[model samples]
Target chain A: MNQRAAILSLITPAYLWLALTILLPLSAMLYYSFLSDVPIGNREVSWTTENYRTFFEKAFYSELMLRSFKLGAEVTSICLLLGFPCALALAKSIRGRTKEALFLLIILPFWSNALVRIFSWTMVLRGNGILEYSINWLLPGTGPLDLMFTYPAILLGLVHSYLPYMILTCYISIDAIDNQLLEAARSLGAGKLTILFRLIVPLALPGIVAGSFLIFIPVIGSFMEPRLLGGRNGTFIGTIIEDQFTAVFNWPLGAALSFIMMGLVLLILFGFSPLVRRLK
Target chain B: MANVSVLNLSKNFGTTTALDRVSFQFEDGKFFALLGPSGSGKTTLLRMIAGFESPDQGSIHIGGKVVDHIPVEKRDIGMVFQNYALFPNMNVQANVGFGLRVRGISGSEMKRLVAEALELVRLSGFDNRQPDQLSGGQRQRVALARAIVTKPRVLLLDEPLSALDRTLRLEMEIELKRIQRDVGITTIFVTHDQEEALTMSDQIGILNEGQLVQHGSPVDIYENPQSVFVARFLGEANLLRGQADGKNVKLEIGGTVKTLSKPAYPQVICSIRPEKISIQKEQEVHRSNGNRVAGRVNEHIFNGTSLTYLVQCGNLVVKVFVQNLSGEVIPPNSSVHLFFRPEDTLVFPDA
Candidate 1:
């Protein structure tokens, strides 16, 4: 009993810190969602359900949420398709020092700040940037192309930022496969293509599911990619929430939108949990 | 039916040669075992025959056709891995039917054949269960069913019984021999267990250092080993290293020693199996015997059915086995006389 109490005492500090830092803030945000922001002469102090009501009544909020989901799905699917094959190649072909070097290359972009990584894509995709210059050079008479502040740029940055996560998870999974299983399949008269689909893919499915969740959730909540690259036609829910918090000073509405986003994240997790269990 | 001929095979990984120039032949429908320690290139040779490996320089002929360049799937060969590599996601039926399905046979015909193969290995009604749900012996039987379903021209087993328990390994060995005979498929098995090789193979090829040291029937290899390594490897033997003079060999033991048969060369080593040595009472020992040694038992081990004695003669300690009669027992630290017939001794060229 004394030992148990001592262990609990040692863990108490971290427990209190987590509750105060994480749980309390999230709880406060949930509470704030039910409150309404009113206009006073200089400041506002009112409590009502109008903020939640306004969000539910507006179709634009729902459209932004749907659009974010669509973009997140696209980014996740593209990352999986490209990342799985790249990871398989890396796991199978590279060895020793070369494998370490390739792994380092995959994770090198993560070392830089996220905003800088997003901005780097802008320099290349802008109207007068390297992509436009290349197109003009290749087509000769073609004028400069405009790709700045577009959906493609945002999608590109999302995939670029999250692909390493997918690849690393997939590499770890694929590397755990026993080489003898592949040989056994071949000996049973399975061709290389059959082995890939029937053996390798099924065995690596858990990694795919894990990578999907890692890339999808973050991409949906991302604000910088859409904010930097989305022009007049492009707007995501994350950017709208950012606008409400910083530019408009509408903390109650922002809190409502954040709660809605958290609900959507939970829904997405609910949808994916069955799939993860099935893969296992 | 297939006869496999490996001619002048050599494989090198980087600078280290895993297999030297090796050659052997397995007649059709014969159970051949390649017996060796690890790194003796037995598995490499088996892999080459199964078409998973291509030798740097060699010609392999199965059914009198050169198959050195053929891919594994095109060779019509079945292999059982040591780990019993069954597909984890598939049931036993699907795994057993995989080869048939690959060959474009499916539906009722595939089902019948898979059932028949599973029945042959005595694994019926296990088709619906996954591999992990089965016992080790059951899993091995499923692996065998999977391999034999396609009626392969040649069956290759790479240490298949190595993962099973001792009793299970013994039972599976008999099962494998029976199945191989019943199917009449030419089979080549690779194992490091000498007893398994001696018991199961119609012909045993003893390999050492990537070279085939001896290839013969189990009896010939065991009774007439051509090298000290073979005699020591196959079973227990007491080696007497001595100088060869004409047709007579001289031993450092306490008696006059003579060779049973003279080799063309001089300077030989002789090996005597422990079972061939007879222990006699002092009064029953004849003085005019061809070879006899005087020794005292240093240690005795009672092995249920037999007693093994470690006897010291002069400066050499020799092991001898005595069958236990109903009431016979030998205690340790007892005086004993060891005798052997001259022709039972094996003489090899000096290493």
Candidate 2:
């Protein structure tokens, strides 16, 4: 085959899969979002912009969307702050098979079922659970901690689920940094903190950014973790969208909300794309 | 200015010894080269002095104060790495100002000092260029500028010129010495290149097999290497084994060559530099300064300004370098006589 034919053959499968799974669904959603009702059986359907109008008119929906975005930002921030150090330690301090093993442990959570992992947190975090029991055992008479089924419970679960993405990104980036650069920094009279703040943080920003997006995209669309761990406080935009699709049968409203969330994600990516390209 | 000294330093990496009981002192305001082959512990010793590694058994003193206990950041030394590790994220100006900034010397004064350093390395206009944008030689200059901007007490260079091309290396060698002289900081350089060490350093320390074979002025070490390793490592040396008797030695190649040094042992080996040996046609008879051996020319290497003749004697091929001032070139397979002075021969007791 010619080069053009060869290149097309290589890319056709991926593009075909994406078009089937994404483009068709998105186009159908957009069309359904503009309709007044579902065209089931032989029922007459009418075109309307009421589904999008309902989103702007409802204060509850807007508040939920904002809350979901805020949650995403908070979890992403915590993951970055915590995972960056772990990655630095893994990439710089440890070496050989030990490094490999520790890295494997960090990414081990991905291999198992994510829902199972989220559910496991309840065993450790519930009132009179392992965490509370351990503290009470140490103190001899401490009361129940009442840890699970709260906002913090949801935050913890989200961070645990997504921490590896941050760490893996940062590890690949930090590991690529030359040891000579660090040695040169120290030789020039820069302290450990100075080397970290001035050299490492600035150099590893690309990883931090890429990891943030990876967590942010999934965390914003999440309903399973919040539903299982968040209890009453888990009523974010994702849950509301789930309610529209499964409980309310408001397919048009659900389609509109999904499109809006996707629009927000695209805006964010566009806003930061130049910075990422420059860093590269 | 500070004179750095290491006393009885040794380091081991598991089963392999990187540096073995090495002791040396760098005098104030001098350029010293730690010359060795790969895995000869030259880089290890440099790292120990730079505080990247501590010795397993010994103390390091900088300006009469023990610095082995001190950390690298507090050691007040500058290092130029082999790859010229300039920060790729920053421009030349920021890179040179990093030491000053970390030390809390900012503002216009920092700018002035950074500019002066860039000027010192002749990189004044390259302040805005990042490391990736600069050429290899330019990046090296930026690294040098960054190293010396803080006026560090001592400078350590780990094969600083090895990354450059031959012509660039020669150019940088002259530039390095000029900047070193201008700054006059106590500098210790490391390299496996013999000619670079000889050309760039005032003093040379030769290392081999994790041991300090010899250390002295470049001319002293070159003219008076004390071991077979040192003699062979420092440039090209022709080794001739013989039985020593008083001022004359019986060459293995069937002749008694006169020597300037007397040996007490019966078996001795003499090192003769190729440049010290002269080649002449065997038919032409003339008095030389010392010993002469008859041989046939095996090959002649024309090196533009000089010619190297590989002459075959009894069981040995002796190398002779004759200056190419003569218009006529000697042909191969011709009989020739090799003359070398007794004072030029360095004798070692063969063990």
- Candidate 1, Cα interface RMSD: 0.8
Best of the candidates, TM-score: 2
Which pairs in model 1 have colliding backbones? none
Show where candidate 1 strays beyond 4 Å.
A1-20, A38-47, B263-265, B281-288
Chain A only: TM-score per candidate:
0.90, 0.95
The CAPRI quality class of candidate 1 comes to medium
Give the per-residue lDDT of model 2 (tens digit) for B1-351. 799999999999999999999999899999999999999999999999999998999999999999988999999999999999999889999999999998999999999999999999998888798888998899889999988888888999999998899999999999999999999999999999999999999999999978998999999998888888888999899999999877799889877788868866799998899999888887875866688888899998998998988999988999888888876678999998888899987788898
| Candidate 2 local lDDT, residue B85 | 92
Who wins the lDDT comparison?
Answer: 2
TM-score of 1: 0.95
TM-score (chain B) for candidate 2 is: 0.97
Docking class of 2: high
Residue A215 Cα positional deviation in candidate 1, in Å, after optimal superposition:
0.4
Fnat of every candidate, listed in order: 0.73, 0.90
Give a tens-digit lDDT track for model 1, residues B1-351.
Answer: 788999999998888777899999999999999999898999999999998789999889999999988899889999999998999878999999999999999999999999999999998888799888999999999999999999988999999999999999999999999999999999999999998999999999988888999999999999888788889989888988777766777776746566667854566777899999987655556555757778877888888899888988878999999888754765666667788878877788886
